[model samples]
Target: MTDTSKKEQLYELIRANPFVSQQDLAVELRLSRSAVAGHIASLIRERRLLGRAYVLPDKRPVLCIGAANLDRKLRTLETLQMGTSNPAYAEEVHGGVARNIAENLARLGLPAALLTAVGDDPAGSALQSRAESAGIDTRGSLRLNDTYSGTYTAVLDERGEMVLALADMALYDKMTPEFLASRAPQRSSAAMVVADLNLPQDTVATLLQDARRDAVALVIVAVSQPKMARLPQDLHGLRLLVLNRGELETRVGRKLAGDAELAAGCREVQAQGAQDIIITCGGEGVYHTSYTLAGEAGLTWLPAPKVDVVDVTGAGDAFAAGVCWSIYQGNNDLTLACRRGLKVAAMTLESPDTVSPLLAADILEEISEFHPLHLPQD
Candidate 1:
């Protein structure tokens, strides 16, 4: 056969049998083993085959695109002293809205990927390494020279409630439309896309536009009340929007009073184009509603299981992860999803870690609720 014919045959063999060895390809293509190796290398260079054993990059992961930061939290031991320093304990961890959610999904045994800009610094290295170790695909993440990784330092009272938070995350502003476009292949292939408001307004718009074009589920998680302005006025392609009551009020440009007012505010956000809205009330519970082709699904409230709060940092992200996992598992019931979200949030609140290392796939099954464990007899 000609060189072109040999290469074509080699690819066909690999496609038919992904586990076919180089030696088998040599015999199948009537070429030397070395020649077969060359052909395989050529095919990989052209992006036909993904990796060893002819693995394909075909997994439809939950694509999370936004900030990844180094987190520092300090909790005071004594009563309040605003102007002067108080005795406290400090802890550091890898954190960011998207990053924390991605870690949670990965820990829940879902295929997850992250696309975010990180500085080529030690902290950034640790961030990527930790995500990869947690089974998050970070290949599409960016590393820029001379940019220090973003940092979020939170000060908490003795009760573990956040008092103030300071952040230096200018690096995410560099995430441009061009950068997002460069990762279009990932976006197009995702089962769903989750983004945080830490990104710039234009970048968020680009992501929303791309999600609309690709007909993919896009979920937006608000990072903070101040960053709510970074969200575009049009959220037409959004599948779900998870935010706190304060963030929702900021989005609706009004102060929400009670459940009725919150539902109205959610409708206002729905008018802005979010398909579903989940407004977390921390310990109180969550207010949520879903929209379909017909019309608005009725709003519902689910109280969180009462638990002693250990740390409140990861509760929101964990809740978002729980809802995302439920949706990924084909459960569109918003009430049940919020139940799972509340469960995850409660678990995270009891742990001091940001992404709760204790999360596992089995947590999705509420042993106390409907699901029961049944083991096979030996």
Candidate 2:
């Protein structure tokens, strides 16, 4: 074997058993003790293994990369007005697609790490504190000087439907390919990587390239219809791409009239190299397809459960987290994952918070028993 391949094998052995002795590693690889030591030294030089105990970098956490923002929601107490100020109730929270998904994953008992750009301002500090309080690891998150943290403001009608939303997410412009490359070790060791389209197009492409090279499970979440272009036309290494109907329409450049059209559009995107695709139809349900070992290709619809809507914000992020949790369990049955996604979406729909505070590791099990998600038989 090549020297590089041998070193990789030795490193993996050490990773599997950190306390394994060098003699064991030498015997396992049928190499001399000196050769094993050389490989270990090489691994240490590459930072794949740290310290003298063969301390490998952690590989359990799901890495989330993209935007982290301070979010504000204003709900109008009365009907619409055009040119004048309207009375409303306001609430502030820390929210961003990646940040929200990371929080959801953390609440679901996953080791979640967030790597997003933040400012040195109080809002940025508050955002990081809130994320840490939510059990997310923000040590790798970028903190910039003299920049305002990303912010999003949404105005909702009395029915909790969004009237208008404004986002000041220019800070995400700094999430460039170089920045992601600098965090190579963290990204490389993650169990999975989840990134949002809030990143620049070239940066997303760079991430996709890395996933393909390392055989990593990379999931990309769409942030907005306009941001759809940030995703490269070639999605070869993508494990999944979760997007809403509007976002899908934007990506494929056509209006998905109904189920048939949506399925066709998803298939088209999958043909472009995505292993799976989920297009969420708000209030309607989620349509998903997966490419498993058995090569399942048909898209199935999971109807959303009826819930008393309090606020619709962050429901999609919750759904992404639920699906991620199911995947992390090593189950390839994405159909079941869709059910979990819908359950979490339902939970979020019933709450006013960006991420439902009711979320817990066992919350899915608690809700799954009573509310079994199923499609209507034809």
The C-alpha RMSD in Å for every predicted model, in order, reads 7.8, 7.2
RMSD of 1: 7.8
Model 2 misplaced regions, further than 4 Å: 1-59, 290-296, 365-378
Q: What is candidate 2's lDDT per residue for 320-376, written digit by digit as tens? A: 999998888787677778888888888999998889888888866543332333322
Error of 1 at 220 (Å): 0.2
Give lDDT for model 2: 0.85
Q: For residues 1-378, could you state the per-residue lDDT of candidate 1 as single tens digits?
A: 589888888877776655577888887667899898888788879887665666445556898999899999999998869999899999999999999999999999888989988999999999999999998888888899998999999998998999999999999998888888777656655788999998999999988887788777889999889999999999898889999899988888889877667777877788888888988888988878744345544466677789998899989999999999988877777777888888888889999999888889999877334321111111
Best by lDDT: 2
